[model samples]
Target: MFEKILIANRGEIACRIIRTAKQLGIATVAVYSDADANSQHVKQADEAIYIGESPASQSYLQMDRIIQAALDTGAQAIHPGYGFLSENDQFALACEKNNIVFIGPPVAAILAMGLKATSKALMEKAGVPLTPGYHGTNQDADFLKQQADGIGYPVLIKASAGGGGKGMRLVERGADFLGALSSCKNEAKSSFGNDEVLVERYVMNPRHIEVQVFGDSHGNYVHLFERDCSVQRRHQKVLEEAPAPQMAEAKLEVMRQAAIDAARAVNYVGAGTVEFIVEQDGTSYFMEMNTRLQVEHPVTEMITGQDLVEWQLRVAFGEPLPKLQHELHIHGHAIEARVYAEEPEKGYLPAIGKISYLHYPEQNQNVRVDSGIVDGDEITTYYDPMIAKLIVWGKNREAALVQMHHALGHFHVEGLGNNIAFLDRIIRCDSFKHARLDTNLIQREDEFLFKNIQKANAQLIISAAFTALLSLFKQNITANNPVWQAESLWRLNISNSYPIKFKLDDENILVNFSPVEHGFIAEYQGQNYQVSGTLIDQNSIHIEIDGKKDKLAFSQNETALTLFSNAQNFKFAYIRPDFNTDDSDSNDHNLKAPMPGVITKVLVSANDHVKKDDVLLTLEAMKIEYSIRAPQDGIIAAAYFQVGDQVKAGDELVEFQVLAEDVA
Candidate 1:
């Protein structure tokens, strides 16, 4: 085994690899960018090296700097965890030339499967099942439109070198093909530097099931079963699980054998995944192969009792396969939810800030969390927005689902918006519980699934009110004196009726509180309640209200106060009584950057009259393009930013002239 291995990545996957390497008595080296200087992964590694600046192109994607760091540290092998240079063929070849082992598949296999169109053609030739579409090298707009016409409407135009849904577009009609194709090509060129694309039939209600395959240099290989990655938004997976629920035994065997065959056909080595799109009828088609450890690999690890990182290390050392095809066994069901720093209600835009407060639930036999962030870490805009991954395991699928729901509720993160509430809603959906999932699940049921979770539970409101009252009393006691007696104040205001109204969601609640033993007694709608608890800190209170015990944590800063309970975080504040109290001069009619990004194009010019929804400009961030639209029907009074300018979130890009009719 190698004495030291360099991890050429950051975030949760970097931390995950270091953990297994430590368990195996191996020292680990971590590489980080400027943004990740104080990251959790950097602190956990035995040795750390500074790579480059915050931008990935300057840091994580710099192959030479990474290889030099490995050489400087005397690392025998380099492990590319998931993204960045993980699947770069040239990086693997560079390691081979430098006599440093790459803990992944060989360069040839990576090159073979890296291009989507090329891989699809290769699979077809090798007798692997493929979707019926155009994989030819035709790039002309008219030619592609003809192909789409032949394939029928609702076709998918995918980048030949794309992954993670970048450079992809779905066209519902032939008339819209040209514009969508142009958008896809532009995105592909910017994201992957490859503009080649392929058109295919968009499979409706198709479940994304991928089989994990591992191989050795000696041409030995085996499959580690499958993971269902159907819960997605914008073609990116948000949740995943191993041993797909409601999957027939016979179909599973077929997928397993096909995955093994796909690996053998390419002479694949190290850890790789063969992805497939399975329809409702149980028929599956080959998608593409990922020639590196996946972001969702933990689900497979939990179900199979195998450390994929360990396997990568062993395979790089030229070891033979540890087990044969028949030796592998799936023991239990496991699910993983990717917690991202994005707001689902706000179109999942990336959120960035310092993590003021972070609380992770305790790990047990069934629940596991993999994260590379902490309370004080800064979530910058330079990298992927995934904050952490929550994984849970159980003896059965239903049990695993239940445990996953509970785990998501316990995860508390503040100072930035997240998709925790969105994840909780997904797991509780009837269609999801019945395993009726598909790639379009998020788009199909987004309105119902992404609704505000804080407003759903009535019990939570009472709990928050009780906890809030306790906090007020605790603050009074603490402010008065350190050793002040609560008994003396208990008798003074026992019957002083004071009405306090609070808003939970859309509803308002009126309650009366009076001093009581230990805490306060709350009365609402003729219900007598004894709420008692000592405040732990500014953020949390332990109390029993109306014979129901609850632990509530409240975080109040200048802007908002979020209450954590029932495994979900709820934001509450004193709703200002007056609506027009703020300074009117601060209400500027200007278009601002939603997030830090490079302006790709400016669709409007100064003095141009525009209507609401008119495109003003487009910005690219983290490989996703977002168009900034006009807020109202107005003239573009001034354009502050131009194409190719880098702008930060809230930085003004354009000024809109308010019309007299609109001023009212």
Candidate 2:
């Protein structure tokens, strides 16, 4: 084994590799960007090195700096975990030239399958099932449009060099192909610095299934079953699981063999994944191969009872395959849900902020959480916004699905919006449970997944009220005098009751509280309930509401109060009745950046007329582009931001002037 290994990535994957390296008695070195100075991955490594600025291009993507760090730390091998340079063939070759072992595939294998169009052609020649479309080298726009026309409408234009849905666009008709193709090329150029693209038929209701394949330098290979990654949004996976549900044995073996063949075709070494698009009729087509450790590899680990990182390390050390194909067997079913710092209601735009309080569920044999985040960590806009992955195992698929829902429900995060509730709802939905999954599951089950979770749950609704009151009481408390803490907040001597205004989302709630001998009485919406509570622990509150005992997990910050209970998380914000927010606001015609990001495009200049929903400017953050649009028909009065300008959330981007008649 190597004496030291440098992790060429950050976040949970880096932490995961560090754990395995420590067990193997190998020292681990972590390379971090400026934004990750105090990150959890940095703290976990045996040694840490600063690379460059926060943006990946200046830091993580600096191949030379990363290589130098490995050499400086005496790291014999560098593990590129999943993203960033994990699949960059140049980085792999650079490592080889530097005489530092790259814990990944050989350069030949990477080159063979690096670009989508080239790989698709290779697969087609190798007789690997491929989607019927254009995967040619011609980059001419008109030529690509003609190809799309031949492939029929609903064609997908995708970046030929990168994955994760970057530079991908779906065109519904020939007339819209040019616009979609242009946007896709721009995104591809911005994201991967490559404008080349490929066209494919957009198969509706397709499920994404990938087989895990590993190879050795000695030409040995095996397939470790498969994972279903169909539940997605914006063409990115939200949840994944091993032993794809509803998969038949014959079809599994066929796909497994195809994956092994794909690896063999590239002379692939170490761990890799061969993805496919599965149709409803049991047919599958080759997608692409990921050349490094995957984000959802834990589910495979949970089911196979093996550490994939250990395998990666052993393989990179020139060791033979850990076990032959016949020696491995699936022990149980496993599922993983990716929790991200995003708001699903807001088009799943990434939410960036300091994490006030973070807690995953109590982990055990059946439940596991892999995260490189702590309570005070920051989710900056410099990189991917994934917070953590929740993995669960069970004896069967049904049981695993149940465990996933339970795990996601217990996962709590605050100070930034997250998709925990959205994930929980997804796993619990009837279609998901019945195994009716596809890439469109989120869309098909939108009504149920996005429904108000607190509407029918009286306990959760009341808990939100209790949380708001207790938060206010605690803020008034101090170490100066313990008695003044509760007394100053309640004012029981002078006033028995007071109206406290609060808000949940857009609803304004008026909660009336009055002091009682043993506890307090609170009323809302013409309903009264007796409430008494004392914090049992830092995150749990022991409360008796109307003589009913309940314990709720709680946390608070300056602006919002949160409570987790009954498999639900409720956040309530205190509203000040004295402040008239509408009176102080300026005209509503102005455009604002929805979140902090760097401006990438300015579609309109001052005095330019635009219709409602016209894209005025584009902002890029968290590796995704957000379009700021005109709220109403208006003329641009002033453009405050230009391309490449860094903007904070809600920062003014373009001020507009709307005529009263036009606005009406």
Candidate 3:
């Protein structure tokens, strides 16, 4: 066992590794970038070292700095949790050269599985079932198009060295192949510095099931069962569950054995995952192997009751497998939802801002939250936008779904956009509840998942009004004053009516509140309701409206007030009647950056004519590329930013002069 280990990663994974290290009586060292100087992982580690600037290229990906940090801290082993240098073969080799243990698979295993093309070829040789497509190494665009044409339409062009949904595109027709191929290769070059790509048949309605396989240097290997990661958006996983619902025991054993064979073929050591795309008929095809701990590994942990990080440490220390295949069994069903700080309604664009208020569900044996952020921490464009992961376990899949829905409902985030409500909808939706899942589940269930089932009705209006008034009253109360003085507003015999206005999305709401004896009468939409509210805590309010009681979680900032009820979040902006709110000068003809990012491509110049839907520029943020398009046929009046320019949300990227006849 290592006396001390250094985690060459940040955020929740790094923090997660440290907790297990501490439990094992091993001191842990944390490496941080400028952005994560005061992050939760930094505060939790036994020792901390500054690595470099905020950008991952200058920090986490700087293998030398991370290795040096491990050496300086006297760390016997370095754990590269998940991203960054986790699967980089050179990093593993470098650790071996420095006599420091890399708590992961051998460099040989990493090299074998590093590229999708090579890994698929190797898997085929190992007798693992593979998808029917081209995995050969011809990088020519015409050659790739021909392969795609032969494979049929709707082929997936994936970056050979990609993971995390980057550098991948789906072309539905031969005409669109070249363009999609170009974008895919550009992203691959930008993200992995490898432009090589492979064409695969895009499996429709496929379920992404991956087996968790672990091996020790002693030639011992075991599979920890599987996780279904089919619920996805933008080819990225949103929800994952263990023991994959509806899989037969016989079929599972075959996949598990295949996974073990994959590990054995590479002489793999430490933790790795073999992913497969499962069809509706139960047939499965080999995807790629991830040679590190996955983001959703907690789901497996909950079901197996084993600390995978601890296993990694033991394996790296040359210990034998902790448990044989027969000894390990699944205890229950577990599911994990990735809570991201992004707007689901706005094409899931990453949101950046300080977390003014953050509340997670109370964790117990049934619910767990893994996060590396606290209140006042900012979500920046420099890193992934995942705020936390909420994992829940239950005796069965249905029970787990129920737990996850409730857990997601209890989550509240303010000061930026988030996907808490979206996640809840996913768990509660009929398709997910019935176990009808696929990689395109999100798209198929889009209407229900993004539905506005609940709105600001009279009950909600009264609750919001009473809570707002009580919050103000509590703020005005002081230690030197009697509480009755603060309560005098209700004591007055006269009914003083206060008119409050709020904006929910695009709808405007008006409510009138009049003081009464025990509560206030709220008039909304020409209906009156008696309302009273008590502050349970800073983030919660217990309210009664018209003899019915409800408890709501709420958070307020300078601009918006948010309320969470019935598994949905309603964010309302206060409409001050006295303020002049005219947007006559605001130009709809101008194209603006939807979020903060760095401009990577400027496809249009000033005075250039462009059709509607033409790509004007491309911005890269949080490792995702977003194309800014012309909203209408117009002539570009000005292109404000060039390639490589940094932009903030709503910064004008291009000004357009639209045809006057088309304006109306």
Candidate 4:
């Protein structure tokens, strides 16, 4: 085995590679950009090197810098841990030219599968099942539209280069084809430097199942079963699992063989995944082959008892296949949830900030957390927002799901919005539980999934009031008695019998609280109860109400508080005070950036007339593009940003002049 390998990546995947390298007694070097100087992956490596600035193009994607770093650190091999330069054929060839092993597929394989159109043609020639579509080299828009017409309605236009739903569009009709095609081509050109596209027949109900394949330098290969990645949002996977639920052995065999054939077609070596789009009838089609390790490889590892990264290392050292295909067996059901720092209610925009408080649930034999962040770390907009991959294993799918739900509830993170609540809702949904899933599951059930439920409970109001009271008490006691002990006695009294109201969804709850012995007495609806607790920390309060045997863990902030108990989390929020009845409303209106991102395009100029829902500008962040729209019919008074300007959340990008009659 090589003595040292340079991990040419950052974040979770870098940490993942480092852990395996350490297990193999191989020294690992990490490369980081300025934005990732304090990242956890950097701290875990044996040695670290600064590559370049924050922008990926100047740093992570800088082939010369990464190659030099590897050479300087005396690394014999370089592991491109997915994303960034993982699939860059030139980078792989550079390693060969430098006499350093590239810990992935050969350069020829990467070039073969780098372009979607080329890959499709290759798969077709190899007799692999393919979706019916156009793979012609012609770039004429009219010809593409004609091809889409021949393929029927609801076709997909995809960029020949890159993935992650970029430069992809779904056109339901012929009339909208040209416009959507132009937009998709523009996005593809901007994202991948390639405007070429291919038209494919869109599967109505597609289940994303990918098989993990490994190859050695001796021309030996084996498959590690498959993972079902059907749960997705905006064409990106959210949750994944191994040994797809409700899948039959026959269909599994078909997919397994197809995956092997796809890999062999490219003479693939090292770790790669062959992804397929399976229909509801059990028929599957080859989607594309990922030339490197995948983000959801952990799910496959959990089920097969294989360390994929270790395999990558062994193969890079020119070792033969570790095991025969017949020796691999599916051990148990495993599930993985990708916890991201994004708000589900806010269109899943990337959230960035300091993680003031972070806590991972206690791990057992069945549960595991692969994370690349710490409590004090900041989640910035310069990189992917995935915080961690929480995975769980069990004897059966149901048991694994139960454990996963519990683990998600127990996991706590603060200082930025996240999708834990949304994930919980997804796992608990009836359709998901029944395994009635497809690529469009999130979009079809988005309304039910992203609804905020914390605003409905009366306990939320009580929790907020208790939190405010605790904060006030702490301030007063500290100001008056600097040396006050934790056991110091304190009492508070209520002034008026005002009702505290809370609202979630459309439901309202009213609660009243008054002073009592040690704590407080509270009444909601027709029930009366006694509540007592001490502030355990800045965010949580240990409370016992009405002689409950179990102590409740309550966390409160300005907007919401979650009551945690029995490995379940119930969210609550303070009711917005009614100020409209007394205070006059301000009439200032402006368009703001929803998240920190670079302004990609300005759709409207100053003094331009626009209707409600007209495109105002586009912001690109975390590799995703979002188009901001006008809230109402108005004239653009001013525009604050041009293309390529970086802006933060709530930063005004445009101002509108509302008519006198339109102003409320």
Index of the highest-lDDT prediction: 3
- Window of ten residues with lowest summed lDDT in model 2: 475-484
- Model 4 scores worst on lDDT over the 10 consecutive residues at 475-484
Whole-model lDDT, model 3: 0.89
Name the top TM-score candidate: 3
Q: How well does each candidate superpose onto the true structure, as a TM-score?
A: 0.93, 0.94, 0.96, 0.91
- Candidate 1, residues 301-420: lDDT per residue as tens digits? 898888888888888899997778678789889999999888888888988888788888679879999999888787877888888999999999999988988888778899888888
- After TM-score superposition, what is the CA distance of residue 404 in candidate 3 from its true location, in Å? 0.8
Best-to-worst ranking by lDDT: 3, 2, 1, 4
Point out the higher-scoring one by lDDT: 3 or 4: 3
Per-residue lDDT of candidate 3, residues 1-664 (tens digit): 8999999999999989999999999999999999999999999999999999999999999999989999998999999999899999999999999999999998989999999999888899999999999999999999999999999988999999999889999999999999999989989999999999999999988999999999999999999999999999998999999989887788888889999999999999999999998888778999999999999999999999999999999999999989999999999899999999998888998999998888889999999999998888999999999999999999999889889988888888888889887888888788898999888888888788776555666677667766676676774322344335676554456556767778887788888877567666788888888776678887788887888888898988767778878656777788765566788999878888889999999988887988989989999998888998888888999999988999998999988999677776
Report lDDT (CA) for all predictions: 0.84, 0.86, 0.89, 0.83
- Steric clash pairs (candidate 4): 455-503, 455-504, 456-504
Count of steric clashes across candidates, in order: 3, 0, 0, 3
RMSD of 1: 3.2
- Number of backbone clashes in candidate 2: 0
The superposed Cα distance between candidate 1 and the true structure at residue 15, in angstroms, equals: 0.5
Best of the two (1, 3) by lDDT: 3
